[model samples]
Target: MPNPPDYSWSVQAQQPVDYQVSMVQGLLDPSNSSLARACGADGVRKVRCLVVVDDVVDELYGDRFRDYFGAWNIEAAWQPAPGDETAKTLEQAVAITEAMSAMGILRRTEKVIAIGGGVVMDVVGLAASLYRRGIPYVRIPTTLIGQVDAGVGVKTGVNHGHHKNRLGSYCAPTTTLIDTEFLRTVEPRHINNGMAEIIKMALVKDADLFELLEIAMPVVDAGMMADRNPLSIEIIARAIAGMLSELEPNLWESVLERSVDYGHTFSPSLELRADPPLLHGEAVGVDMAICVALAHNRGMLSKEDTDRALRLMCAAGLPVTDAVFTAELVSEALRDAVKHRDGMQRIPLTTGIGSVRFVNDLTDDEIERGLDFVSQWAAEHREETA
Candidate 1:
């Protein structure tokens, strides 16, 4: 029994990972060379791409996509999966991975291209990460929400059981190519859905962006494209820049003091539990409203500021109140968030329009009071608007 012969060993290493998030106008257009270059299809003899697109996106631009890829000398395996939140599951990821494998996708050279909204990106990106342990992928976020928030981040996840984003990974895409042209086809409510993340950025880190949202809400509500409304473009640009600035340094979230979590802390449960199934941004809007009330209760934000924030959300057509957001639900969401944040609720709250503070000592009493305050405020605001 020679003391096990000392067989254990250790190795230490450091690896740097960097990826680009480019904003191009017409990424899928046959004439546009940006996507081709981003995927390294320009100089390559034959580039193989396994595209996991949202079913809706495929319906809208399938022929054009095929034409563009063919013109670029790339062999593409196009697979469309439902992009709804209900479809963001492990099963979908497995299907995409299996499809890619059948298409002869090379682990190192061939790329998995996720082309659609946030759900498509999450499922496909997760599949890409799981296959062969890791593989390259590109994100083409079609929805405004995907472009400004989900698409730029280095996170891939799917829902499990009753939890939102319970199954996931920290897999970064090779590149995130955002094209505003895709926003043109998004429905009005979906456009407003994307505004929630922009509003979150404004609430947590950019007062200037908040003011711009105030100005751009009317244009956005009118469903004007960025070309027609310059302010709209400016708003999108500022939101993307703010998100990237916050995420670039904390990609792995090694430091948990994340301002981007302002509206996200308690929204996951709310999003998953709603009867009508609130959109991701809609749930976030409700969560932000609650945090605004909590900040006001703590005297960190003025009543005027709180009302203004809520009003901006209203102008953007986002919901500030939902029947499903009861005190019990709030408590449950907080519990889930606390567990996710390693037992210390790293809840992000806005001290002002553009500043944030994370607190770990939130009491149940405070949550109840905040819920009451928001419910009252929402009632009064709704009457006024009516």
Candidate 2:
């Protein structure tokens, strides 16, 4: 009788994840039917959708939004929320969830569409993931960062306890619909902020993308990234493709030596600690600059490559250094990263543009040297920035 229940049962299964990133322009134009189709609009049946919109996006496109849905016979319940970094919080996610419930959204039939930057998408995705355990959601990423980076991935998150993305989930949206037209209204600096993520992908996985960025630097400098420009579309599309390629193989991130992590190692702390918190891309730019310095000191990156990398970032209106970024901060951030990456500092360093090498054995002295290099470079380029 005592040994009767000694046998143990084990369950093993593989959960398949499938999602798409659609590059649809004029998504909000009254004549466009892409969004209508995504929201389940058919010729005869009317569609009811609960849309979580950024306050800024709503303010800018509210009328057109109504017109777009009206033309497609979609009854949209507009739920506008703050779409900045501060809105990346658990409370905001809860608010979005509350909005979903009030709409009486059907779990499988109805989909929540998030219209804004990365923050709005994250909040909405998290809410959708938790409502009744799971529900499909759509992302119409307006910001550059959202379209190219955050919106392409399956991760949804909210900031907690003064930490960036401290509480999160890996829940892919039903689909992410990208429309560069929304960027026409985005501030230049905000657009540049998104370029940081694009640049990160270029520096680690695609040299050709880096070249396109360089070629387009002047256009970017002038803040003239019009959707009509094929070059601009190619740039964003390439970055998005490269990011997805890297991510698809390791969607769960079970392998921690991620090339996509090049600039993220220290950015979170600096990002959260800034008095006026840096844009996510700004913080990442600073982090990438540091990694460039680290790579240079390790003799992994050529001086020519280093200069090109930093100069491109500068031309794109990104900060390569922050006063708070120091050797001490580097050490602390790497330590935290080590813990996060399962006891190994899987720090991704650029061997050259479009290539990376992970180093687990980084010493404090090495980190100090990296910081020194950054200090020197920043000082050398001080006049350019001024």
**Which candidate achieves the best TM-score against the true structure?**
2
Q: What lDDT would each prediction earn against the true structure? A: 0.87, 0.87
lDDT tens readout by residue for model 2, 1-386:
47665688999999789888999867777667788878988735787899899999999988888888888888899999998887789999998889888989998999898899999988898998899998988899888899999899988999988567889888988788987878888898888899999999999999999999989888673235646577888898899999999999999999999999989999998898876669999999889998998899889999999999998888888888888887787788888889889999999999999999999999999878877887789789986444
Clashing residue pairs, backbone N/CA/C < 3 A, model 2: none
Shift of residue 20 alpha carbon in model 1, Å: 0.9
**How big is the RMSD of model 2?**
1.4
Query: Across residues 224-301, which tens digit of lDDT does each residue of candidate 1 receive?
Result: 743535787778888999999999898888887789999898789889988887999999988999999999999999
Clash-forming residue pairs, model 1: none
Runs in model 2 deviating more than 4 A are 221-223
